[model samples]
Target chain A: MRRIFTVWTLLSVLVCASQAQSTGSSDSETIKELMQEIKELKTRVAVLEARQGQPAPEQAAAKPAEPVQETPSAEGQTLSPERISGIFPGIRMAGFGALSYKANDARPPEAGLLGFRSGNNDFAIGDVDLFLTSHLTSKASVLSEVVFSENSEKEFELDVERLLLKYDFNDYLKLSFGRYHTATSYYNSVFHHGQWLQTAADRPLVVEFSDHGGLLPSQGVGVSITGKIPSGSLGLNYIFEYGSSDIHRPNILDPNADEIVENNGHATTIGLFARPDWLQGLEVGGSFYHDRINPDGGPFHLGQSIGSAHVVYLTPRFEFLNEGFIIQHIIEETGQKLNTPAFYSLISEKLGAKWRPYFRYQYVNAPLQSPVFSDVQLRHGPSIGVRYDYNDYIAFKTQYDRTFRRQLPDINNLLLQLAFRF
Target chain B: MRRNWKSIIVFVALLSLGAGCVISAQSKEEDVAVIVNPQNSLESISSAELRKIFAGEKLSWNSNTPIFMVVRAPQAHERDILLSRVLKMTESEYKQYWVKKVYSGDVPREPLALLSNGMQLEAVRAEKGGIALISLADVRQGVKVLKVDGKQPGTAGYPLK
Candidate 1:
């Protein structure tokens, strides 16, 4: 630990020196004052320890584990050494993985089994996210995150996830610009890749739209403004983006196929997110997204609008989450239809300090179908699972899902996951 | 057999009551500590200097290692006392510190807490510059006790009394 402290101390000094050189004025004075204060504080503490018959400075300094609390502040506040060390810019990386199994009472033509019994057994990488954040100034900063999947091999790609420059205008207001993840549904803003701290292994199906082609604009090149409401700490975040939709290929074809066309469509999205502290640790918000895709002259022209509302409550021992989504689409420039409404809810409770067990239910109906299809369809399921926080940096999870189809036998599946962050 | 079972239950109840009283009394006195790396040469730190360090206002020690402040859980009693004494801020203020720091990519390490005296000692011993407060009786051989505002732990200058 002493070594760690020494390294951190050196780094801080280097940073202060650089700052002094660059500013060449008031900052240098500040640095000198701070150093002098620290030296005096240390001397005082050593003397006090000696008076108590505790080990003297030399002896205590030799032992790495010695606890050293600084004197209280003039205001009587106790400062934490860890925070002081972190003032310098640093980087963090984190991620999670999942494995799932499924079983079906009867064989379904569309289902394939990789890890499933009577279906497919599949081992899949859920989310692997790496984060980098740097401070350009005392009041301004930048944050970036990259997500990788499927063993981080073939399907790996960078999502310019959170490339935003933030300016802290004040204690109550801030401004940001650049490509950033939209604060669309409550779930979208809270990256699931950082889900180790969450009480559940999987997000509600209604909000887990990444697997089904983000129906909502996930990230957009844009600008945003956030502020706290007057007289209260209700936070409000508003973002507007004028950019193209995220690039994605249709799920129907083999992802490896080279001939697969890309959906290069212009898009715009506006979102509003609010969280009030009235119910500490509880977050509630909503988002609206519209997309217009002028596909490359195929029958698959894209024109759709989606909106969703969600509420989430998080505490150390339990969580409650619910969300609903509505989509409207125009097909072939003539046929217009309303997609099925989707909804989901989940309740999770911590079984112990490290383990959380949860249950979830979700339902979504197929969009209105042409008379030729003979039937409208809906998919719903109930899943039970547990998540283990191995530590602040890692987690392990497993889940079992029993899905019911409108016209088919129940499909039961299991999932295992590992998530980590640095 | 019935009489013996009743007697056992009575004894257990009395023992539990005694344990509860002891726990209640202990909980009343907040144990917290100010920590620094053993390698640091400075002997005494003022309340103001400590505040600046924890608040992210002071960045270094004698222009040395970047100061790393480890906070206790917000709900912990020691944290409350620490905040009141060092930051001169309420719990809400401390929360705001983390929220702002995280958004700016300057968040400190998550605070580590030890529920028992043994655990607290282990943490202080394992991490250099680690500081926390516990019962004065629990102060062990591995950690140094620092004076606040020129007052040593047992002197008239001690902050606690």
Candidate 2:
């Protein structure tokens, strides 16, 4: 990791030098001076680490961590780091994992032995995400996150999480266009994915499962405008998107079927959101998402409207977040109705520099009245988890969930994860 | 009678601790300012103009030269203080602002940051249209401080102190 940092620093300096030459200014000299200062900083850091008796850089490099990528513009005017450790624009990686013990003898003979499990072991690489951001020009740059999932082993997926072109109409309003993740839920807006390093292993189901599958509208190509209400405590932001949806089928049930529906069909979604941040660290917002999917006589018509509202309070040491969602799916011809209303809450506390323990509760009620389902039921659960942030890029996590349901034995699971980003 | 004395002692101790905490917290808070190159002369700047410069709207020095704004890293204390005081924005708000800017191709640079206070001053001095916040005690030559609302830091009319 240290070697990578050094290499990256040298490359950045070279890039900046070239840009400075092109701009024909004192930028090159500035770059040289900045490089010298960075060197001095390294020395000072080394001395401080030694004085503190901290582990050597080589030892620290052994851990799986997020790789911080720093990009210096060709013009030598800006220096943007992927994630800041102590400041913004710094890059970091975090990991999460869990283990549990389950009781095996409490179930019927036909059922598996795992019942009321006290210690059942399960481990995973929960979230591996790399975040790269830069302020390339005074008015523009980019923010991109690459996520790697171990559970599916699908390789790396580039979530252009936020690629926006913005023109500040003024301080009160800014217009943007490009691919960006919708600012739907309070938590979803800021580092929603597991690798972003949340205190909880599992987010509230309302915010987690509102969309098809477990993924939210992580990215959509569209235009959005955000601005603060002048002289008012309210901050308003709205987004309109018209493009292909991000939903994909992992595997086809029958590849050889005569009538097969291609997963690469057309879909569109529009979202509207509002947030008020007058109160420090506290944000209250709501969003509406309408999706239209046109499939070629597929099993599902793929038309749904989801409305959600969320409130979040973030403090230096503690956070309280809650979201409620209502999803209505409509069949193309039969007029069948599918309604799902859900709510979830998460309470997180920062135990210290490296440890954060959290508790989450989720309640989801799926009505069985739709043509797509034969059974309708409600599912709710409580999960307890902890996050160990070794630094900005690497973390260790463990979580246990006990789910309560009707006409079923309590369901419990444990997970251990090592999450990292590059 | 003995119990009353113990309670009084405990009460006094708690009050003193509370007072100590308030004082310590106040002392830790540092005042900052937005600075510019001494060669460029812009009279009193409005809140809206500051927002434009900080948001990368007005991207040039007073001389009509392309303005190159300098920003501290997001995690820097001075950066946070600058956002809250000048932009009146939170960390997330500021982040979103920059992210939008990057996507637009309007601005191609992220904020520049020095690991220490001394380095921050050096960077500002070397660059033009370079604006950053530093501790009031750390202000020095090479860079001139801009009045946020027509008033200097020590003046009672100062918008931000």
Highest lDDT scorer: 1
Error of 1 at A417 (Å): 2.2
lDDT of 1 by residue, A250-302 (tens): 22112232222325465566666565545544666677777665434466665
Off by over 4 Å in 1: A1-86, A94-119, A151-160, A195-197, A209-214, A231-242, A249-266, A295-302, A368-377, B1-77, B80-161
Q: Work out the TM-score per prediction.
A: 0.57, 0.59
> Residue B85: error of model 2 in Å?
9.9
- Residue A202 in model 2: lDDT: 50
Q: Highest DockQ: which candidate?
A: 1
For each candidate, what's the DockQ? 0.08, 0.07
CAPRI verdict (incorrect, acceptable, medium, high) for model 1: incorrect
TM-score of chain A as modeled in candidate 2: 0.61
Best by TM-score: 2
